[model samples]
Target: MANRLLEVSDLEVAYGDVRALWGVSIHVEAGSVVAIVGANGAGKTTLLRAISGLLPVRRGTIALGGASLAGPAPEAIARMGIAHVPEGRGLFRQMTVLENLELGAFQPKARANMRQALDKAYALFPRLKERAGQKAGSLSGGEQQMLAIARATMSDPKLLILDEPSIGLSPLVVQQMFSLIETLHRQGVTILLVEQNIHQALKIADYAFVLKTGEIAMQGTGAELIADPEIQKAYMGVLEL
Candidate 1:
C-alpha cells in the first residue's frame, strides 16, 4: 500500500449558501505530486483553501498522517505541515524579499531552523537571493511567483498546495516554474497542484483529478489521464497524437 500523506474525503465548501465544492475526494501519496485541473470557478482554489483550513468545510474530512484535520484553524493546519500558496502571490509588497520569506517561518521550530530554510530557499531561487533587500512589489511577475513558492517552502511543509503557480507568467517563465516544481518533487516534497494548464501540469504530476462543475470528473495516473479521450477533449482541449 502507498503511504497516504493527505486524504480528502467527500469534502464540500460553501459561502453564504453558494456551494463551491461538493463531495470531492482526493489523495496524495508521500513524495508525489498530485494535480487538480479545471476551468475557472470549478472549485480548484476552494479545495486548496479548504485543505489549508482557510475556508470552512460544510462536510467531509481532511486527514493527514492518520489524524483528522477537520475544523482546524488555518494556523493550526499550517503548524501541522501544510502550506498554501494561494492564487495571487500574497506577499508583503512593502517588505524586502527576505522579510516576506521570514514571515513564512513564524512557527517556533521553523524559526529555529531559519538559517537552514533560508539557505534552502536561496538555493532554490537564486534570483531571490540576488534581490534579497529589494521590496517585493518591485520584483517582476515571474520573480514574485518564485518568491511566493520560496516563502511557502520556508515552513518546510510536508504538503505544499499551490494554486496556479504558472498563471500570469510568460511561457518561458511558466516553463521555469514547472521545472522548479519537478525539482521540488525530486527533493521529496508532496505537492497538491491546482493548475488550469492541463498538459503542462500533467507533465509533472504523479496523479491528476479533473474538476468540472465542482466535482471530480476524472481521476487517474498522469499518463492515464493524458491518454484519456474524454479528459483530453474536456480539459486538455486538443487531441494528443
Candidate 2:
C-alpha cells in the first residue's frame, strides 16, 4: 500500500453558525497528486483552511502521517510539513523576493538548511534570482505566482496544498503554472490541489474529488473524471443531450 501523507475524514467547518463543510473526507498518498475540483462556494478553500489549521474543525479527524492535527495553530501545521500556497499568492508586497523566501524557512528544521533551500528555490525559479532584490509587488502576475510556490518549497514540505494556483493568470501563463506544478511533483512533492480549472486539474491528478455545496459529489482517477459525462457537462462545458 502507498504511504498516506494527508488524510481528512468527516471534516466539518464553519464560520460562526453557518456551516461551510459537511462530512468531507479525502486522502492524498505520498508522491501522488490529488485534486479537489469544484465551483465557487463549493467550500474548496474552507477545506484547505481546515487542513492548514486556519479554521477550527467542528467534527472528524485530520491526520498527517498518522498523527492527529486537531488543535495545532497554522504555524504549527506548517512545521509539521504541510505548506499551503493560498489562493491569493500571499507574499509580503514591500519585501524583496529574497526576503519573502527567507521567511518561509522560519521553522527550526527549515531554518537550519536555509541556504540550501534558497539555492534550490532560485534554481527552480531563475527569474526570482534575477529579481532577488525586486519588490514582490512589482513582479508580474506569473512571476509573483512562481515566487509564491518557490517560497513554499523553502520549508521542504512533505505535502504541498495549492489553492487555485492558476487563478487570474492568462491562458498561456496558466499552462506554465501547471507545468511548474508537474515539475514539483516530479521532484517528489505530494500535492493536494483545490482548483476551479477542472480540465487541467483532472489532467494531472492521480485521483480527484468533486465538491458541491461543501460536500463530496464524486471521485475517480484523473482520466476517469475527465471522461465522466456528468463531469464533462457540468464543469467541462460539454453538451450532452
| Tens digit of per-residue lDDT, candidate 1, span 49-126 | 889888889999999887788968999999999999999889999999999999999999999999999999999999
Worst 10 residues of 1 by lDDT: 232-241
Whose lDDT is greatest here?
Answer: 2
How many Å off is the CA of 1 in candidate 1? Answer: 4.8
Positional deviation of residue 118's Cα in model 1 after best superposition, in angstroms: 0.8
Residue runs of model 2 more than 4 Å from their true location after superposition: 239-241
Whole-structure CA lDDT of model 1: 0.92
Q: What is the TM-score of each candidate against the true structure?
A: 0.97, 0.97
What is the total number of backbone clashes in candidate 1? 0
User: Could you tell me how far off, in angstroms, the CA of residue 103 lies in candidate 1 after the best superposition?
Assistant: 0.9
Candidate 1 local Cα displacement, residue 7, angstroms: 0.7
Report the lDDT tens digits of candidate 2 across residue range 1-241.
3588888999999899999999999999999999999999999999999999999999999999998898899988898999999999999999999999999998988999999999998888899999999999999999999999999999999999999999999999999999989998899999999999999999999999999999999999999999998999898887332
Candidate 2 — worst ten consecutive residues by lDDT sum?
Answer: 232-241
